[model samples]
Target: MKQSLTAMALCLTVWLSIPVAFAGPPHGGNPGRGGGGFFDSTNEYRDAVSLQDLQERRRQREERGFERLKQLKWQTGYTMPQHYRSDRYKVDYNYYQLPRPKHGQQWYKVNNDYLLIDDDNTIIQVH
Candidate 1:
């Protein structure tokens, strides 16, 4: 009976001590001063543009691309249907046996008659 009681008391003591040993200061207390999270660096950027500005830029790009394609078609010597109109035009100067110029802005004539038109459609240039 005494041995059984001693074993029970030992068991009780160990059970009680388990929680005490587990209860230490939290591994790392919150930093004493205010600090942002890992992703909260102040130097990081989060600025955003207004939706209207974004939409306007997209629209301008689409318009410019369409006009450029149309111009390429017209300048490439491709025949456009009677009812068809392209925002872009292309003229082919290869048929005339003319040497290709180094600069694209230099105009070239095609079929002894056609003129290549170069124009700024909608691109914005920054100095």
Candidate 2:
């Protein structure tokens, strides 16, 4: 009886070891659903953004920001590192002893035209 049980167990193990092949290759290789069969045809679009493209995008963004800053400086006459009047102030010209926004509240540049203030004094708009 023990030998019969052992044989049955061995048979069960061997049956389990047989790989159950599906009707098609695993999901990643077929376009019918999940597999990468989609690559069978070539198209204009390609995978992965090149580093050059990323750098170009970043350059464009920086240029746009500089242009915006130039326009703002001309319109507001407030240049950085020179301590211009912040919107939180009532007077146009005042000493540095101004009530600045509290901690956690960053100075927000509004509409790229004016500065907007929130309850927390965080700048919400940047034009």
Candidate 3:
């Protein structure tokens, strides 16, 4: 009975120690002992500034594109540029609270304006 108890105690000790052995070093085992994660250095600040500058440049480029679109004087009788005729620019008239287009006519959204174009790519109207 004593031998059996000794064996059980040894088994329990080994079982408990197994978890501690595999637990690994505390605090992620960082040799430098630095606990701060990700944004923990001066480089992080530089990265943030560069990211903001990139965003600003993107905004400026988009504004320039919109300005270019606005510069085109869309007359009623003139044909619209070919690029604007793509399906991507097409919009539903009812969704924009505009009047339904006549046959062979479709509505297109360019920047903030709505343009109605005919099948021949002529600018029927601009709103």
Writing each residue's lDDT as its tens digit, candidate 3 over 44-104 gives 7878999999999999998897688678877799888876889999999888999999999
Model 2: per-residue Cα lDDT over 1-127, one tens digit each: 9999999999998788777533455334766654455654332133334656888999999888766755653322233322223544322112323245444333443333433234544333322
The Cα RMSD in angstroms, rounded to one decimal, for candidate 3 relative to the true structure is 15.3
Off by over 4 Å in 2: 1-49, 73-95, 99-116, 120-127
Rank order by lDDT, top first? 3, 2, 1
Which candidate achieves the best lDDT against the true structure? 3
Write the residue-wise lDDT of candidate 1 on 1-127 in tens digits: 9999999999999998999897644333333333443344341343234566788899999888666645553424344332222433233447544345334322333223344333422111111
lDDT at 68, model 3 = 88
TM-score of each: 0.22, 0.25, 0.46
Better of 1 and 3 by TM-score: 3
Clashes counted in candidate 1 amount to 16
Q: Considering every candidate listed, which one attains the maximal TM-score?
A: 3
For model 3, the stretches where C-alpha displacement exceeds 4 angstroms are 1-67
Better of 2 and 3 by lDDT: 3
Candidate 1 regions exceeding 4 Å error are 1-49, 74-127
